[model samples]
Target: MGCNPLHALYLGAFLPRPPPPLPPPGGKQDRARAIEAAVMAHWRAVRDWSPSRRMIRLASPDQEQEEEKKRDLPRNVVVEAVQHLLEWGRQRDQVRGEKHRRNEEGLRPPPSSPQSPSGGSSSCPKAPCSEASQPASNSQPSSGETSEILNQESVNSSPAELDSGVSEHTNISSKEKTPSGLSNPHSQKSEITVNERFLKDYNNIECIADGGFGCVYKAHHLLDSTQYAIKKVKWAIGKEEKVTHEVEALAKLSHENIVRYYTCWTGKDIFPSEDSDSSSGEEKLHKCLFIKLELCKLTLEDWIYSEESTKNYKDDAFEKFQEILKGVAYIHEKHFIHRDLKPANIFISFQNIIKIGDFGLVTTGADDIPVKRTRKKGTKSYMAPEQVGQEYGNKVDIFPLGLIWFEMLHRFKTKSEKSKRWEDVRDGRFPPEFIKAFPTEKSIIKKLLSKEPSKRPPAAAILRMLLVHLFRSSSI
Candidate 1:
């Protein structure tokens, strides 16, 4: 055996090892074979992992088919769809956060500040008549109620004053102190606490318009017995910066044709208790912004539809159009674009003055250079082609003005007709009636509505043209 050990090792190395005998073909053997097959398949899947394969593995047949269909879509289309989904998810999260916040802190109603003491004569130098000077009766609420109102009013009571340019005759009460600790003899301190006073002074609180951002209330000032409009807007979580920007822009604007911004106030809700259940009990407090603005007799749209305006359209249309141009020119002069200019945003004051309002979408230039807007904002029907989704200058405003001007010149019998006219404008077509009536204006309108923004005239040029037309028409 010892002599044969080396020979046996050599023979073992050369010989192949026999395989294990197969199990008998029975129930247990079959089951074991199936299990082994499944294990091998799973191992293969793990080794060849991919998104599509993983999806196929996890999804139902129907789901997989739907995914396959989506995969066949254009790359850009797929990317846009994904982006839309992501945006929707973000918006949903924001909405949930807003709901949670609203639940925690109840909605704050509009502030009803304490009324100013009555029994004052027309202190305003240019104050209307004695009848208009009468002070409104202040509601005699209890001391505690007054205190609560005062506390709420304190939110926006930071000392601010009306611009002296607003009204030359606006008499500032000697008691009101300026920010510099000096008495401003010209302007009165804009008191947020005086909102209740305004409510007391104004008898009627009629809601003229309701929009997504705010409500417009028509009220009359008891002191001057003059009607005014109050815009009350609800403040959203991320829109504070936009609101602030609008306020700042409006503060700087002081054109006779532009809507006068009297004052603004922010109100917050007073939550009684942190533990108060908003869901089962009462609605939560909502923060809001109140903007006091000059009252107007009618918007340009209303004026256009009014019997008086329609009857004397030929006589007054040019004058009113000139006023509109003046307002827009002033806006441009201030290096701002009245991005949302439309008939609805233009106002006809009681004095027949045309004023531009609604600076919510206004954009300003940096260092007098033109600003480019990337987003498609403003009423789509009135938007210029460049405004739809292109880099545009202030000349973009001219296009809408041209539309408004065209509208002023022609009267549409139906909304359908009006829509058709807008479509025609979009396609660079002017109404035959407008062309026949005003050939010169047609040329101007064509330039204004030009597809190329650079070709459109500046606001100053438009104003000059309007002025020339006014002069010629008046002389004729």
Candidate 2:
């Protein structure tokens, strides 16, 4: 018995470690290889295919010649191509949404229980149980089409699927259930369905600032989970017209320094149902009479003036000032003048990126021709000499920038001379001592704050001078 126990102990010590678990049968690697093979097969299937059936080449002049060569695709290849493209698009959208959400940093939350922008009723085909209702009869076909296009352009799909329960009832099947009983081929349209929960949360946002133009609010988009400083034009005819003009102008213009116009939304009445009798039943509907914008932080003016900023973030203010000039430089390069280039109109993002905002006073035309104006625009202090009917053009824009720069550099000047111009000071009425006190590259400041608008440097020249000065100053 003693010999048997000793032998067992020796056997346990001599065990072969179970052959190292047989490398887990290599299942994961095999699965990975299978997936890669399947992907390569799919790529091979679609690799040589052109993006569209009607591929146009610059060299091909004759339409018939172009049509002669078929793509030589597999049967129903177009459908397959479209389906794959859509799926890829969906994946891309998902990625973008995720990136955007992450960037938002929890400023906005997901919508709770989605409801239609109009109401619970689906009078809008996009809404649930809604019938085919035309937009206001007074609305021109052109306007209606434009609105539809804008709406289509603005709507974004979520990274994740909309609550799965509601997703099935959304697109094709919903169309089939409409009261018309006949499907209009052209009638199926994609629309921006602003969930009520989203709109309420967005609209309830705090007012960041208010001005003659409108009230700006810090609103968030629930879908992408992004925040924006929304400038809401007061719901009035004149203000509304200005909003349209700004939109039209910005649509035609693109520049890095200039604030980007994202999308505009306006409300229109949906006609009451002919079959239903609710004439005086107090039916009410509203579309989002709002514009979506890239959310930005406060303007530089507040930062410069704030005591906390003065102590902690003085250098940041100066850096932001340079960004403002870059923005102005871009405007000038485009041959457009931001007639309003004051600190109030310059917006600073959280990342410290600066952009020129408030296009209400911008003008585009030849240098010789006066910037046509029906009425005076801009704050009093920042208005250039030419803006006050002094034959202003591109140079007029830079004057305000110079004054703003002065304001940022020298906080000694108690109040901005916005109510008047350089001429007002040079003419011995407003006191040149105050104007001369502006701390800057002296030569540039002199030219920028020149009495004659024509004598002042154009925005480009000013920008170059300022850029050089900034570079030199930073090096020192």
Error of 1 at 262 (Å): 0.9
Off by over 4 Å in 2: 1-204, 234-241, 268-289, 308-318, 412-440, 470-476
| lDDT measured at residue 420 in model 1 versus the true structure, 0 to 100 | 66
RMSD of 2: 22.5
Which pairs in model 1 have colliding backbones?
Answer: 106-284, 106-285, 107-284, 107-285, 107-286, 108-285, 108-286
How far off is residue 355 in model 1, in Å? 0.6
Can you write out model 2's per-residue Cα lDDT over 1-476, one digit (the tens) per residue?
Answer: 01122122234344433232233346755544443333333433332232432354434547535443342334344343334434535554654564354334422222223446754423223532121232212211243442332232122232112211111122222232212223322343222223343343343355566655655567655445578766555444545555566667677667666677787766532222321376676534433245556666777687677774666454665567667777766666666666777877777777667877878666675653565674456776677666776455677766676667656655543554433444453332333554465345445666777767677766556667766877887899
In TM-score terms, candidate 1 sits at 0.55
User: Model 1, 1-476: lDDT tens per residue?
Assistant: 01122222234444444443454577954645543433333333332244565768586978867655653434343333334333434443543454344334433323233234673433432322221344522222344543342233122111110111121122223244333333332432222222343344455566788676666778766456677888766677997877776778889999899999988877743222331655667545557677889988889998777788867687688778888888887888888877788999999988989999988788885323445565887888888777777466677688898888878878787898887667887556887777799887778888888887777887788878877876887799
In model 2, the clashing pairs are: 122-130, 123-130, 228-295, 380-418, 380-419, 381-417, 381-418, 381-419, 382-418
Clashes of each: 7, 9
TM-score of each: 0.55, 0.50
lDDT on C-alpha atoms for all candidate structures: 0.62, 0.51
Error of 1 at 249 (Å): 1.2
Judge candidate 1 against the unseen true structure and give its global Cα lDDT, from 0 to 1.
0.62
